[model samples]
Each structure stands twice: as structure tokens, then as C-alpha cells.
Target: MKNYKSYIIGLIALVGALQSCVKDSYLEEVNPNAVSSDNYWSNLTESEENLTSVYGGLLNQYLWNSEVEALRSDLAFPRERTRPLNYGYEWHSQSFTNTISTHYFKSWNALYRVIWRANQVIDGLNGMDETFKSQERWTTQMAEARFMRGLMHFYAHSTYNHGEIIIRDKIPTSSEEFSKPLSTSEEAIEFFRTDLQFAYDNLPNTQTQKTRVSKGTAATVLGKSYLYTEEYDLAMPLLKDVIEGPYGYSLLTGDDVSLLFTHAGDYNAESILEINYTDQHARLIQTTDSWDEEAYTTRWARYTAPTNLGGGGTSYFVPTSWLTYEYSNEPVNPNDSRNYISGTNIAKSVPLRCAQMIAVVNDEESTYYNKTPGYEATTFSGTVFSHFKKLTNHDIVGHEDEVLSTSWASGKNMIVYRLADVYLMLAECLIQKNDIDGALGYINAIRNRWGLMLLGADDGTGTFNDVTYTKETLMDHLMYLERPLEIGLEGYAERANDLRRWGVTKQRFEALAAKEYNVVNYNYTKADGTTGKGSLIQEGPTVNVKTDVNTEFDDAAVNFIESVHAYLPLPTDEYLYNQEVN
Candidate 1:
């Protein structure tokens, strides 16, 4: 909960300076003019500082805060398909080529940089005196470092690369150590599991800084790794531990759910691990005009805010119509009075999460930017009628141009893992384990928070909405609906990863392409209890029929060759520089 962004800022600068001097290497370099490996690890303070640098990798906007990762998935796509936006959208169309390096190189390099930093801390700690190394502080920091190192490898190998990845477990001092061949998939998972196991065994339940990894964080991520590798039995108990552990993590409900992506929600009870970004941008801006002032902040808002609201023109990645329609299809919470328009039985017609996650031009009634009259979103991108409201200060900031009115680099922390994600994963595992009854509880907990209809009916009917519950049916709901609705547009390419792991990427896109999304004329009650009609895109007669089936979706469905597109290739420069790669 403490402000550690300043420490992250300094450590990032140190890591950059160290990396700049290293030629044709992936490991951290020892600079003759600066602190060297021989003297840097003398005390606990220095080791902890290096560990902070490991967490700084999460601040890589290209990886987390920006749309680079999300855009790779089906949840979002570039608002404009211009040449400048080619790399980001290429992942969708399966036209990926290493010639365009901005998205590919930055994200790949960022993951490895964290791995290198974690390796630096682990190596430095291993070199300390036996007496010092045996202390609680040393063990804890080592556990933290290994946790980070393992998580990065998980990202590089399992999440992004989807195959062999270099296992940089130690700092390379010689040329032989500098270049290593990629580890086999089996070897990579083994190394990943081992590192996370150590962290889980040694890390304490709590940390002085909440941003640092804890026992629950290790368990959640380690459990997720197991899920990715098809070790459902192994994943079940670990995820359960975090669910029923001493950690006080719980789901954020009601208004708090809407605030999850805003600055106020940073380090909240549901959050397991989050990257710390400083909220002192206003004060820092006054002191200097240099980049340091914005160094600790994230430009996520500047990139994700709607173009109408002054977001970057080149990278305007909005939520795809497929995603918005998916969220809209959630059964309205019939029991909640707020779901109904004032003095009428008519429901607002959009689900609670749809209102919270994206701005539907016509369906929403809430006061956007706190305007006098609600539902103020004027336009969206292309044929898409919704814009991503998550990770933007649209609601909190009292202005039409939220990103421009606020700091250039916003300070909202990016949450990597949370309790809701764990619940959904548990449901997934439970369904895989054939515990249909048990899985329903986990899935329904998420729905109950929003007062939406539960998956299964009461009285042990194993039915909801007159549909019988089966393992396949429940799995389909969790896989296609619950997971994307609850945690979409959050996490690190999780939607894309989920589709791949389920072996349904092409099928999912095909289904999305075939489906028709109706942009209906709807009505909502305004703040003053007056009726307001929203007909942003009126259809032919009664229903405005709009198929979200675009060229992007059509191309992705047909051209997404699993061998080539399922996994991102290692940056070309990596093979060029590393002799072992050839």
C-alpha cells in the first residue's frame, strides 16, 4: 500500500543503464563505471532494491497497461487499421511478421528484462556469506526473486512464446553462459514449477509493501501455471488454498466493482498482485519537465481512452463488438431494483458489468464524466458501438476529454491477479474434475455479486433458464462467458491464452463472426427520475440489426494457423544475436 514507485523509478533507470552497456547479451551487464556484481550485494538493502526492480517490469506499458497484450486477444482491436497500427492488429489477422518490431520487441524484451533482474537478485543473494544467506530476510527476498523469475518464464514460454524459451536462471559471466539454447517445453514447465514451489514454500503470508509478492500471490500464479499445462488435479488444491487461505481476498461488489480499474481500487482487498504506479504526478510535474516526473506513472489512460476523449490516434484499441455483446447477453439481475427504469418494470436492458466495463452508446444510463444528463458517449470507433471504460478515468474525471484533462501518464496501478480470477479458475478446474455441482458455486458467486441470475437453480435442480447443467454445458459457460465477462480487458492476454488452451480460438472467432449483434433503441431513467430514450443507432423498423462480423474477425477465423499464430515468435534480433538460437 505504500508508495514504492520512486524506488521502481530509480531501479528502472539503473537496469536500463546496466543493459545499455551489454552487447549481444540478454543478461544484466556489469558496468566498470557503476556498481558491479562484486560489491552490489553486500547487504540486505541492496538485495531488496534489486528485487524492487523485478516488480518494475510489470510497469512495461506495452505488456500490461497498454492494449498490446489485449489486442492480441479477441477482446479488443485497433480502432483504425492504418499502417501505424499494423503490428497491434496483425496478431488478429495472423499476418504477424518480425519486420514490425515495436509491439513484438518491447513486450518480448520487457519479459526477459524482468527475468534477468530476478536472476541478478537470485545470483547476488546466493553469493552472500552463509550466515547472512541463512537469515529470514535473505530467504524471503530469494523467494520473491524466484517467484518473479518463474512468472516471467511462464509469460515467455507458456503465455506468449508457447514453446521453448531461454531459461536464464543465473547471471551469465562468460560467453558460454551468455548464449543458451531454448529449453524444451517440458523442461521449461519443470523449471517454472520449481521456482514457484520454492516461493510458495518460503514466502510469508504478508509483505511490508503490498506490491511485493506474497504467499497467496505465488499460489495464485503457480496454480494458473498448472492450469495452463493441463494439470487440473494439481491446480485445484492450490487455487483452493488461495481461495480459503488466511489471505483476506474477496470479490469487490456493487459500485466498488465499477471502480476496480480506477486509482481508488489499487491494492484493494480483491487484488493479489499489482504493479505500483505513483499517484503524485501533480507534485512531480511541478518540480521538473524531465521524463523522470512521468517515469513512475503509466500512460495506459492516454492510449486506452476513447479518441473522442483525446486518446492516442495511432493506437485506439477499443473493445470489440463481440466482447460488448457478450457482456450485454448476461441475464439481467431481475431482483435488483436498480436494473429497472424508474417507476417502470422495464429493465435498463444492459447487464451491470456491461455498464461498468464499456460505454454502450445507447444502453447505459449512468452519468459519464458526471455530466448532468447521463449516457454522454457521443461516438465510438468504426462499426463498434462501445468503447472501453476500464483502465480509463472516464467516470472519475469530470471532463469530456478525460485523458487530456488528467495527467499525461496516469498513476492507476495494474492488477495482475485477483480473487475473482482465482474463483473462475477454480470453477474451470472443478468442471474439468467433473464436479458440476461444486463448479456452479464458484461461477455463481461471481454472478451473485451483480445480482444476476445464478448458473444453476435452487432446490438442486442443476438447471438454470430451463437448461440442464452438464459438465460440457457448464464448461462452455465458464470458458466463453463467465471468464471473459468477469475478467476480460484485464490481466495479460488471458482471453487469448484461454482460447488457445481450450483449443477453441478459431472456433470462437468463427462463432463471433456468425453471430449478429443488435444495436437496439433503449430507454433509461435519468438522475432526476425522468425518462430518457437512447436511439444512437436505430435499426430498420424495431430492432437495429448489426452484425459485428467484420473483415478482422473473418480474417482471424480463417487465417489463424495454430502453429504460427497461436504462439508469438521470439524477436528476430534474439536469434540474430544469440549464437545458440540458430
Candidate 2:
């Protein structure tokens, strides 16, 4: 079994173990004596503690919420696709046989337990007296609870099983409530909308920390839910509220853009909702050497980073030619300005498929960037294989001494939702409404920040001209081209869900596996310690050496991919255990 202990972090040991949306009896309260069962949640301080646990649910990393999200999308290529632990990713990536693998059960169980806790928190807050806490504070806490409940509901709805999932607004203390029938698609979407509406109405305009939810956060999610359900008219106004709202959110500019990945930029202005991760010491409490709280830090850098670069990573997840060459286009200089070395250290280079791993720089040390033959890598296709740079702060990471294997846990805070995403979605909404000019304004806002040309700007590359865009044309660019490039491999599972909803599984993956595209501006240092830039690209790069590049799209995987339709099968265990799902 892949370790479920770490995945089940910060969960309180209730009377009955948390399972599905059905049990309120596990509401473990203080005063083991008979102080009356009804008044357990009588104070505000205790209610806040319950609220914190609901937020703690976001800390689990082993499930599909984090690294696996990237692995399943076209944005990332896992090193080992057939590994038992990776089945959730494989299933979503259109490769799994009709089987209930570990991933299927893990993701299903992890999220539902979260919903259970959210229900408990909502119930506790509702029963608490207003005199114990301020009317303002109590209501805000309730809004946050509803927000988590809604968000998890949406996540479960979109991530694994879609329409068949249940919605529990009230605390389920009865067996019938726990074993309720699966809801209809319309019912599930409305459940998501209802919770988000509650959150949007009561949440404050802004919060001191990005970890907390706000009106903009709720609005952003509500708008996305509306768009997903094809309620474009409703989505447009909510998106507009986020775009022009008083959330104080703005896209980071110039070299500051990399703050989205670095620890220095935690809770930066662009972040609307950021999941916080701390160091090993802060993430978990050590009661003894062998016994400790679960390490709730994110394992993203460990899976995505290059093993050679002190990250102890497999560097398994790389970018595709379709994403890098065919779709992630460049400015006219025969180079991707987005991926190139700008005059400053940081820019839009992170979204680039390939990355440079910089070594440590101290007074007594020789500060050198890694570019070894076998150690420094390239994929089989001959174009320089890309490595993800957003996972770490561009430093060497080693494992903790107690662990035999390398686990470079950087514990970086992940930005869940932000203003830039709002802008892009707004642009999409505008395109659907045939407001092309309004759409371009949002699109260009992202492009201009990264030092790329605005939509109408004449770069000699012939990338863009003064042609007017119809709904189909704008959507084609935005869907396949713009959004994929802008939001690739950021660890939100955003890209994969988009592909699943768009229904482009077979066509997209088949074309990606067919041929390799050239690596843009492949950079390396010579044996003499001199940097070299191999220019005039678009030739496929074949791997001249053995490295961690073991994944590919073979015939069986692709054929099965085309066979899949809208609903991903629920785990067989779900049917066995729940006794109510179809």
C-alpha cells in the first residue's frame, strides 16, 4: 500500500472514522463526561479550531490534487507511467484498464473525508451562540466553511467521478443520510453553485493572508463553475467582478513574475487563494523519532525536479512537443523570448518547458550551473528535453538524513487561484459573447507582462496580424494555444481538468506522440566552463545518453484513450463500500 498515513494529515480521531458525507456521530468533542451531547460546540475559540482542520484538509499531497494533477495533463510526462502508485494519473490520462487501483480509492476516500469534516465544521458553527464570538467573526468563519465545502464538492465532481457524486449541505447523523443515492449532474452543479453563492455573499472583500478565502475567491470559483456548466451569461458577470473588484490583486511584473514559485513571494499580491506549506519542523510536530505528525509539506519538487540537481527527484515529468513547440509559440527572433535569458534574472521563463538548475553561490563555493552529459539531461526526441523549474527556488535540494531515499521537500506555498486566471477566464467569457476586443485586452495583459508582443503588435515572426476573430477563432486560440501555455504544470490540476471537460483526449494525445518538435534555445556549458547557446531550432532532439525519460504514448494507451467518454468510472471499492453509488 502506498502510505496513507501521510495522506491522512491533521484529521481528528472522531468517534466513528470519517467516511463519506454521512456521519456526524464522529464529532469528537471535549468533556468525555455527560455535559449533554448537544452543547459541545458552545464557544468561538473551539469553533475556530474546527475551521482550521477544514483548511488542513488541503495539505494532503499524495492524492490527485497536486503532482499527479500535472502528471495526467498533456503539460507533464511522468517518468514511470506503469508504476502502481501512478494509476490515478494513468486512469485520468486515458491509459488505465477498467480496474480500481490504489489511486482511485485514495483520491476518492481523501476528498470525501474532507467533505465530512466540512459538514461537521458547518454544523458546529451553526449551533454556536453568537455571544461567544463577534457577529462579524462568526459569520466569516461560516463563509469560509461553506467555501471549503463547496470547493471540495467541485473538486470531487470534476476530478474523479463527475455526476454521480453526492452533495451534503446538512450534517448527516443517520445511516440513510450517509448512504444517500448519487445525485444528478444538474443537482451536483447546483450544489456547487449554492455553496459558492453563500461564500461570495458573506466572505470579506479581501484578507490579510492569501491562505484565507475572500469574496473574490468565491466569485472566481463560482464563475468557473458557471462556465463549466455552460451558464456563460452568469459566469461573465462574476468573472467581471473579480477582474475589476477591490481584491487588491494584480499580476506580478517583469523579473518579479517568478515570485509565483519562490518562497520569498509567499502570499504575494497576485495570489487570491494559496495553499500554505511550511518546513519539516513547522509542517509536523515530532513527538518522538519514529512517531510524529504527518509531514504535510508538498512533494511537488521531489517528483518534478531533476535528480542530478540536488533535488532527489526523478525529473519524470517533462513537457510535450505539442505544448512546447506546436502550441507554446515564440516571438519572431527564432527564439522563445518567454523561455530565453532576459536582461534580468526572472521573467516569464518559468512557463518554458525546459529549465536551468542553478547551483549554490557562497563565498567559499564555486557557483556553477549544472549541464552534464548524462547527469544534465535531454529527452529521446533529440530536441533539448525540458525540466520543470517552478518546483524549487533554483537551488540544490538534498533529502533529510533519516530518510534513506531523497525527499527534497521544499514546502512551497501553492497558489490555487489568482487574478491572472480570472483575467484569462474573463477573456474566454468575452469570446463566447462575441466581444473579441474585450477578450484581447485581457489576453494582451498577460502577454505584455512577460515581455512578449501585445496581440496587434507586429513582430517579424508573423505570429499575429490585424485579423478580426470570430467566436470559433478566438476560442481556438484561447483553448488550445493561450491557456495551455499560460497555465502549464503549475500544480493545480487545472490543465488536466480543462482537457477532460473539453473532450479532446484522443486527438490531442495522438498528435503529441506522433513526432517530436525542436527544443527552443537549447543552452549548455562547454567542458571549458564556457556557456554555449545552440541556435536555429525546431529539429527533434534524440536522447544521446541514458536519463530519466521512460514515459511515452504507445498504441494500446492511445486506442483506449479514444474509447473513453465523459464520466471516469468510480473506484470499484466505492461501490463495494458505499452501497449507494451507481
Candidate 3:
């Protein structure tokens, strides 16, 4: 129902259909021979093709649909922002049910397809001739395939009905075994750990091809897998190795940072592993008309501030005021310089204007030097909101005629892993292990990289900003804020999982939702069209007319976030076909 055409094609290609015909009575011959299991792993080219097919399986739309969106947004259990239509909010209200049957089927089928392909490749490589035995090449390819398989398992485990779901083993001719009983979360996590560990052990530290996975990439992912499994001790060393490894990766400079989200930066050194997409790449060809455009068409308007002025519209995802306020409330004298406001003021509503005006009066200068024209003193009315500026590159305005083109054509490379993530994950593991000083050291290292003031005693930034956090609470908070801010929309899909894993969805929503005002800053223009300093507006206690504020949050709001919702339901069709197994 959800367009299984591509998936079917991938399966057919990867798992060729075979037919047998009898020629002679004594010695029957096979005719119209389909791909046989015996011949599946015969060579290097075949193995490479299988690996390519595996990666292709992950780009299916069924895996990135409304159900996934609900998992990410605040309308359910993890309310980071207070918007009425947030999927989290809707689920919380019981307005909708998690019946994404089609999506579930697609996700399950595609992952199995990837896993099957990986098995074929692995098997084929094992049987390769001596001439094909380049340890470096074979190991790299195998590692990449394993990483892909592990990533799929991770998603499967994370999304499958709270981790009680079927484990697709190899390829199935019928839906029988595939539709079997669900595995426990612990089982799924173990599978993921094993796969990732294999990848980490075999992958190279660096590669001439940026798109390929390296030792660090695999190690980082293994660390993440361990973190998800709550194996802090196991995760920490792997993460630290990634941080200190010679992957030639580091934080992008102030100027180069903007390039990270664009098409030109795809598969750069900073990117550990990423799903490659290109306007020109055949595998990534998706007709824009079919995909949802909410994110693309408005020039990433919903995600950031307005065009020409910085902020954009709020119909799509908007960062919560609580997040903004946290940044604003950073210890002033010795905060990360990167924490300062930058870029243009695009909040055109009255409430936003009021908040910006207030921020300016409070001396919150623009962090980015360049300001968009015609955004001085402008005010937005409805709910004041904050947005990520990382995706606000102007070159992508209306680049596609279909669902908003957050497409790679806009120069935004989707990062699956990076050094920054590695550092933070290590910090998290250390904290979970009750190594407070060790955790702080890793966190401070990241802070220092961003030119921000360090925390804890002896970092020379004075007392620890008066913020007291137990090891678990502080690590949780750091991951929540830092991951979003650092990764932005690129990792938006994972937010809900992080919230669930930390058991802080309800707490974050409650704490963040009670605030009275949400502020957004943007450059504004006067009646004469002259742009000047951005003014803040307030949006809460009712929508302010002047700023065009349209978002709000209240204390009575309850999150319908369920621990169960963290895992997605197994596809019903699989079970239906395999009723005997069920």
C-alpha cells in the first residue's frame, strides 16, 4: 500500500528468481536458472553490488513516514516544544493511534532485504578466489555492509513495538519465519552490538573514499549501540577511540560550518557515515511530487528564521522557547562564545519581535555578523519560537517544484556519525559509569572546541555556573541539548529515541512547557525598508497580534508518550501470512 515497488525491485535484483527445467531423464539440467544460493557469493563485483543494494534498502520512504515523525515530534511523550498539532500532542490526547501498518511492513521488509544482501555479500566474499583476496578491500567492504546491517537492526529494535519484534534472518521465500514472535529488547540490542562490533573490528581508520565506513565510524556506532543497551562501560572505550583516532575529522570552522548542511559537503571528512544522495545519483532518484514538502518548499522556512531576515514561517517544526531560554540563560561572563545569537531575525510576528526587543535590551547581540535586510523591529504575534539556523542556506529557495526539497541538492549532507557525536557519546557513557570528572573532561573538550566556556572545577571558568546535576541527570541534559543543537534537523529523527532512552520525556515536556514566553530573534525592516537590529517579541498567555505568533504551551497539557511507542508494532501482514508461525 505504501509503494512497495522500489522494495520489490531491490529484492528481485538482489535475490534473483530461479526456475528449474528437466532436460534429460537421467541427468536433468537446470534451465532459466535464477540466482542460486550456490552462485550468490562467487566474486568481488557481485559482492560489491550486493553491498550497494543493502545501502539502497535503507532509503525507503516507508521507514520515514508519519509514524516516524510522531516518534520524533513532541505531540506524544517527549514534548520539547509546545505546539498543539505536534504528533506527540495528538497521541497524548488519544486523537490518533499508532497503526502505521503499511510503514511497519515496509520498514521490516526493507531491513530484511538489507540483511539478506549483507549475508550474501559476506558469504560471497568468503568464497572469493585468492586473486580477490585484498585484505584491505575485502575488510572495508565487509565492514561497510556490516555497518549497514547493524544500522538497520538498530532501527528495527528501536522502532519495533517497544523492542518486542520479529528478527528478520537472511531472506525468506514466504512470510512464515519473518512473521514469527517478537524478540526481546535485550536480544535485539545484543544482535546490534554483535554486528557493530564486527564492523568496528574490521573497518579501517581512514578511507580514500569519503562515502565508505572507516574504523572510527564503526567504533563510534558500536559505542552508540552500547549506550542504547545501557552498556556504559563497553561503549566508553570505543567512543574514546573514535575521538582520538586519525580519521582526520574535527569540528568545522566557523566559516566552513555553514557548508556542512549543503550538497557540496556530502561525505566530507567530518562525516563518519551518511546516506549518500544526489540530484544526479540514480539510486537517490525520488520524484519530488511524491515526498512530503513541508520541510523543503519554504526554503527550510519552518525550521529556521525568515528568508532575507533569518527566521522563517512556523507551520513546520519550531524549536521550543525553553531551549532558546536555556541558551539565553547561559552563564554570561564565561559561556561558550558559540552560544551567542547570530544571523538574521526572521520572526515577523509581534510576540517574536517583543522577545527580540527584550533580548536586545538585555544585550543579546547577533552571533553571525551578516543580517538579512528588511527585518528590523519586526514582531511576530502567535507563539514565540526558536529555530535551528544551520539549515538556512539561501541557495535552496524553491529549488524543487515538489514537497519541500530538503534534498541533498541543497548541499545538506545527512551525517550518520561524526567526531562530535563520538565525543558526546563517550561523555554520556562516562557519566553513566559515574565518572563525573571524566565525563566533564569530555564535555569540556567539546565546549572548548566551540569556543564556549568549560564547566566543572579547575577549567578556569570559575564555579560550575551554579548548576547542579547528578551524573545521570547532567549527562541526559547535555545529550538532549547538545545533540539537537549540534546535529540539528539532520538527526531530528532520533530525538524521541534519546528522550525515551533517558526516561526524561515527561520531565522535559513538563519543565519546558510551563514557561510563559517563547522568544525568537530576527532582523526587521521599517516602513521605509531599512533593516536594523533584531527585536524580540513574546508569544504566550495568548497569541500576540503584532508578531503573528501561532504557537503555545500550557501546564495542563499531558504527553501521550508511551514507553511502548518507542518500538514500532511488527507489520500485521507479515504475521497474517505466517499465521502458522504465530
Tell me the TM-score of each prediction against the true structure.
0.88, 0.79, 0.72
| lDDT of model 1, residue 387 | 69
TM-score of 3: 0.72
User: What does candidate 2's lDDT look like per residue over 235-305, in tens digits?
Assistant: 99998898778988788876676555566777777878776765543434532222111344555665555
Best by TM-score: 1
Candidate 1: Cα lDDT at 131: 88
lDDT of each: 0.70, 0.58, 0.51
| Deviation in Å, model 2, residue 248 alpha carbon | 0.8
How far off is residue 178 in model 2, in Å? 1.7
Off by over 4 Å in 3: 1-41, 61-96, 100-105, 126-136, 174-178, 253-256, 280-315, 327-381, 384-411, 458-473, 518-563, 580-582
Error of 2 at 78 (Å): 2.0
lDDT of 1 by residue, 325-402 (tens): 666667755677667877888787577777777776545556555652335645442354566776666666754344
What is the model-wide C-alpha lDDT for candidate 1? 0.70
Q: How far is candidate 2 from the true structure (C-alpha RMSD, Å)?
A: 6.6
Steric overlap count per candidate: 1, 7, 89
Cα error, candidate 2, residue 149 (Å): 0.7
